[model samples]
Target: MIRVSASGVNRPDVLQRKGAYPAPAGASDLPGLEVSGVVEGGDAAAMADAGLHIGQRVVALVSGGGYAQYCAAPAGQCLPAPEGWSDAEAASLPETVFTVWSNVFERGRLQAGETLLIQGGSSGIGVTAIQLAKAAGATVIVTAGSDAKCAACLALGADHAINYRSQDFAAEVLRLTDNRGVDVVLDMVAGDYVEKEVGVLAEDGRLVIIAVQGGVQSAINAGLVLRKRLTITGSTLRARSVAFKSALAKACQAAVWPWIAQGKVKPVLYRTFAAGDAAQAHALMESNAHIGKIVLTWGDV
Candidate 1:
């Protein structure tokens, strides 16, 4: 058995908990995606069955069932915790890193020196995207609802942090880029932002939508897309096949893991609650007041 130290709370967890996102066939009903822990006492076979070992510290992605004393996960999804990192820090990595890598880099094809705009700038995915894009030599812009959130994004290496509530993000983006527009738009707010995102996309720009927090349906401008040759696509990580996720996890391990080990990338944690307080943690995420990730710690870890 493995002892869980910390579990990251995500929107899918909240959705699963509320019955909005139903568990797939043969999946557990528990609500957690990523966790950090140490193996206690289990046979090598059992440990291998769970993709772990006795006394080894690890971080893993779980389909569900993460908010418990002992959680089981496939060994392929687990990675050794970086040396000297806290369980909370290690626990924070998998979900956001996987999501961002799959959506922004793999799908969006964000390239060096490209201009990228990320919505929800203070979110876990937003912070990680900013750092990664900047580190990869891209000019990163972010949009948040509050000035403090904008400042936090700027602090996290965003080139421009726009207050979505105070200004028109598309206009701000246009102004910031001298009307040439951005090369990629990493959007989570899919409602009315669709039109605006298309408006600010440069020639051959890629808009990758990862969430629909505002609303899903929207009117689009086909002419604009055709004129600019923009590509609009979106994806979710949880529903993907294990092989796909494993590939993403492996790619992330190779590209971003070294940076994390060297402190070039750091996990941004907003608050950590106990596992029993998962309901409250979900409530906090819904409030959208957090600047980074909200995690649930198991025991003192």
Candidate 2:
């Protein structure tokens, strides 16, 4: 067992709570993907047998059941918490960091000096992607719904922040890139943006879609994709197998954890609510006014 200090609230959690994403066989019905806590008992002996400390502070990715005082997780999914970091900050890292690292770097094959256009720039995944891409020497462009949200993305090292509500993102992206277009487009808006995303892709550009918040189905321009040699792919972290998530966790620890520890990257926490107020926390996430992460804190910490 582990004492959950903080649990990050994400969109899937809200979806699960609302009966959108059903819990898999034998998984917890509670809606949480990541958590921070101290090891207490149960698997503690097993972890120790594998050379892990019993009372060590750690952060982990869970498929479900994170919004409680105690969460049972496999030891393989855990990583040591950055020294001196708050539980809220540690709690915020696993989901966003792992998602960004996997989708933006490993799968998208985004390289240094390339230009990346990120949708939903103020979101947990967006904020984390902006920081990581910028740190790795990429030019980052982001789209958000409000001026304040755009400014927040810019403050987090985005080279350009477009207010999607005020301007056409595709036109703005084209203007910013001088028609050459971006090397990668990390999109969460999958409705009408699909054709536009394809239109804005550079030669051999990769478009990785991680969510469909706008709408699920959209018509695509096959001609634009064929002409641009674009590649479009999408993934969800929650439905992935344990081995995949464990590999992702290891990759995140190797690539981004050091930067976090050195203060080059940090968790952007929007708000914190008590564990009992999980419903309120999910409601806050649904509001879409938060800049980064919303967390539910548990225990005395």
Candidate 3:
């Protein structure tokens, strides 16, 4: 458990609120998915093994209940907050960071010198993916809904940014890569985007879809899959087992945490609303007007 300081507002939270997604059975029904706070109490043996002590500051990913003044998260899901970051910034890291690390590196197997295309380049997950990919010595191309959002992605170290509204992203990706296509695509918008994502992949390329914001069902060319040896995969983090998430925590602690310490990565917190103003926060998220993360803060936290 933690004395919650701030809570991250993710698209999943919005989906849960509208009944489009539900908390997995035996989990908290509250909306927040991530939090940053001080350790208050927990199972002693578990906390010790997790390298946590009472009063230590940490950020955690949770299934729900992060919006409250206190939240209980599995010990293995907690990570020490990076030094010198504010509550809001730290609050925003766990969900997006965990998702990107698991999907882009673990599932997609992106490696140095590969080219990656990221959908929704200005989202919480998108920004995290861009920096992590670049830091890992991979090239990054991203697609956003507008020019400003595209600029935001570029400024975050994306090698190229496509304004999806002004450009056909698949064509642009091909053109940017000189028709060779990318090695991997970290996708949030699945549905129809899946076909084009498959189209713009090099042989042995991987396409990891983390969300179905566009829709779940998609039609893709089996020939491309066969010829390119493409791998298409997708996952949601909320219902995964504690053992899997614990391993992710260890991976991030070894890899991404050091990057954060070196300033190679930084959390992009677009805004924070008072806990009481959560409705407005959710509205901003659903409007898709923010370029980075949105967080909710508790009283005086």
| Per-residue alpha-carbon lDDT of candidate 2 for residues 68-117, written as tens digits (9 for 90 to 100) | 88898777778898887899988998889889988999889999999999
Candidate 1's C-alpha runs over 4 A off are: 40-52
The candidate, 1 or 3, that scores higher on TM-score is 3
In terms of lDDT, model 1 sits at 0.86
Ranking by lDDT: 3, 2, 1
Which residue runs does candidate 2 get wrong by more than 4 Å?
Answer: 42-51
- Tens-place lDDT per residue, model 1, 1-301, is 4588998888888778778888766667777888899866665774575456678998887777778778877666777888878888888888898899888999999999899999998998898899888877899999999999999999988989999999999999999999999999999999999998999999999999999987999888999999999999999887777777777777888888888877778889999898778788989998889988888998853
lDDT: which is higher, 2 or 3?
A: 3
Provide the RMSD of all predictions against the true structure, rounded to 1 decimal.
2.2, 1.6, 0.9
lDDT of 3 by residue, 1-301 (tens): 8999999999999999999999999899989999999999999999999999999999999988999999999999999999999988999999999999999999999999999999999999999999999999999999999999999999999999999998999999999999999999998999999999999999999999888989989999999999999999878899999899999999999999999999999989899999989999999999999999999999663
Task: Please state the error at residue 301 of candidate 2 in Å.
Answer: 10
What do the candidate models score in CA lDDT, each in turn?
A: 0.86, 0.88, 0.94
* Clash-forming residue pairs, model 2: none
Model 1 residue 276 lDDT?
78
On the 0 to 100 scale, the lDDT of residue 114 in model 1 is: 93
lDDT: the better of candidates 1 and 3:
3
Once superposed on the true structure, which residue ranges of model 3 sit more than 4 Å away at CA?
Answer: none
